[model samples]
Target: MYAYTALGGPEVETFLDLPIPEPGPGQVLIRVRAAGVNPVDWKKRTGYRPAGAPVPEVPAVFGGEAAGVVERVGEGVTDLAPGDEVFGQTVTGGYAEYALLPAALTARRPPVVSFEDAATLPIAAATAHDALVQLDLPPGSTLLIIGAGGGVGVAAAQIARRHDLTVIGTASPAKKDFVESLEVVPVEYGEGVADRVRAAAPQGIDAILDLVGGDELETLAALLADRTKLVSAADRATVARLGGAPVERARTRAVLEQVAAWVADGLLNPRVVEVFTLAEARQALRRVEDGHARGKVVITVPA
Candidate 1:
């Protein structure tokens, strides 16, 4: 199995042939068709371990979500069998010819959804869906999404719109047209960004979904009347100090199923702006790490 591995840090990632991983109880072996590249994927390579998740061994495979054909199922996993088209959150990694996906977290891929689009759902779309659910604002309410040009932000904007929320998203000036195409009011991020948002939404932001952290998040925090409506998936400590909460992700097959349903129904589009072959996995990571990708970037594995 060929996959990209984290060679100690963000500065290094290499492709290698590793032994195919076997599925244990409650797991499934997937012949990966596509894998999604996300900010966390690079962050993990740089040593950012999610809370409560163990640090991976060195030269760890570098991906978080994938979509593919099931090659086999493990013990106690009776709901799925070989040849099922599925997409899900990965317990190990997705950047490979084959990988293990926990059966509980897996969702069936609808015939309407392609492998590339399904691949984007497990992490990026799932996180966006979870973030919107956490915000819990009613229809017609205003919600602001920071760093809205990236995968999660783009998905969040579309989901918010579908749920009838007025979306105001922040991104670099380069993404103005792209963001607007999703029906989100695009605000340029940087100095005085809060003022820009304020001017755009004179009624003030109802809820804020912060994807960019540091001083920018602090500035956006001021736009909200109720700090509890503020959520940050990027900076936990800063959001905590501001009396906001980080995204409480629901890593369940249910969430993936719902999200996939939306995608299947044309209610949500992942806007996968770029696709790369596994041989170009490093370049895919580079696009996300550089923060220049307009939407999701995916790596397609050879069959």
Candidate 2:
């Protein structure tokens, strides 16, 4: 099997003859049809890994989300089996011909959903749903999302609108028309952003989900009537100091299923704007790393 992997310390290259990893207990090996590319993949490759992420062996496979047909199931995984079409976060790397996904985190894909779209749900869409659930804002309340042009931000805006919560989002001028199409009041980040948000939402912001952190997180924190309502996905320490917490993730199989159902029902769009082949996985990673994708990027594996 062939896969794209991140070598030690900022090195990413393709491995054309990697051996397939077997499914372990609570895991399933899938013949990947599509994999989602995210900023985290590049971050991890460059040593900005998430807290407690295991230091895998050199040449570790790349990607975290994928959708495909199950080739085998591990112990205690009874809900899914060989030939079941599923999508979820990868326990093994997703940017490959075959990879492992935790059965508990994986969900059966509805026939109506495409593999490309399903591959994006585990991280971006799931985070959006979990953040909204954590906020627990009532319908009609105005919600604000920082860094709204990106994948997770876009999902959150659409989901919020569907739930009847008005959204005001911070975005780049390049994404102006796109963000507005979601019915979110788009405030361009930097230079009087707070004032722009204020102008967009005269009713005031009820809650905020911050995807861009650091000084921006601090800037957004002041606008909230209740500081505790702010959730930061990027800077946990900054959020804590402002009397808020990090975005709480459900990280459950149920969340994946809900996101998939939303896609099937036309309530959400994964907005996978760029599709790359497995051979072009490096370009996919580059697109996400460049931070200009403005939508989800995915790599497809041919059977």
Candidate 3:
């Protein structure tokens, strides 16, 4: 087996001849066909996340989202058998050609969707759904999504539109047309962002989903009509201190299952902007670290 491993700052290497890991109790072995690369992968590679949690162990596999066919089922796992096509977030080991995931977290992939598309949905789509559904906003309510051109942002925009909300998305000038094509009002993300948003919705925004954390967040805070309407996934502590709500990512099979169904029905979509082979995982991380990808980046592993 070949797996991409992160060795300290700015270093990722492909290790060949790594032994395939066996599934433990309540886990299943998946032969990964496609893995999704996210901003967090780069952050981890660069040591952005605080140390102390696991994954610092050398030769650590670094992907969180993946879709593939099940190769073997562990003890007590009866619902899924060998050869089941599944998708889920692996706590570790997604970058490998074969990885282990707890049976509870894996869901059967929709028959109509490809592994590459299914690979992109677990983390980004689940986070978007959690943010929108947690708020319980009524149809016709105004929803604002900051950083709308990124992977999570694009998914958030589509979900907001499906719920019948007046969706507003903020992005760079280059992404304006793409965001607007999703039926989201596109505004530039920098100086005067709030002013532009106000111009689009004079009555004020009913809900805000902040994906970017920085000066833009402070700007977003000022535009909210009420503090409760502000929700964020990136910076929880900052959002809480500013009297806004932090949207937590839920690791549940049910959420992934629902998103898969929506994708099958054409109500939801995961925009994949780039694809790379497993050997090119380091370059893929560099692209994500550059912070300009329009959507998710996927890595295909040889079957």
Q: What is the TM-score of each predicted model, taking all chains together?
A: 0.97, 0.95, 0.93
Please give the lDDT score at residue 106 for candidate 3: 93
Cα lDDT for residue 288, candidate 2: 81
Stretches > 4 Å off in candidate 2? 1-11
Regions of candidate 1 where Cα sits further than 4 Å from its true position: 1-11
Q: What would you estimate as the lDDT of candidate 1?
A: 0.90
User: What is candidate 1's lDDT per residue for 1-303, written digit by digit as tens?
Assistant: 333355355456676777888899999999999999999888877777766778777777888999999999999999999999999988768988998999999999999999999999998899999999999999989999999999999889999998999999999999999999989999999999988999999988899999998999998898888998999999888999999999999999999999999999999999999999988887888899898999999999988
- Best candidate, lDDT: 1
| Full-model lDDT, candidate 3 | 0.83
- Write model 2 residue lDDT over 1-303, tens digit each, in one string: 334355443345665667788888999999999999988877766656556667666566788899999999999988998999999999878989999999989999999999999999999999999999999989999999998888899899999998899999898898888889888888899978888888888878899999988888888789998986899777888888999888888989989999999999999998888999988887788888777887799999997
- Of 1 and 3, the candidate ranking higher by TM-score: 1
Candidate 3, poorest ten consecutive residues by summed lDDT: 1-10
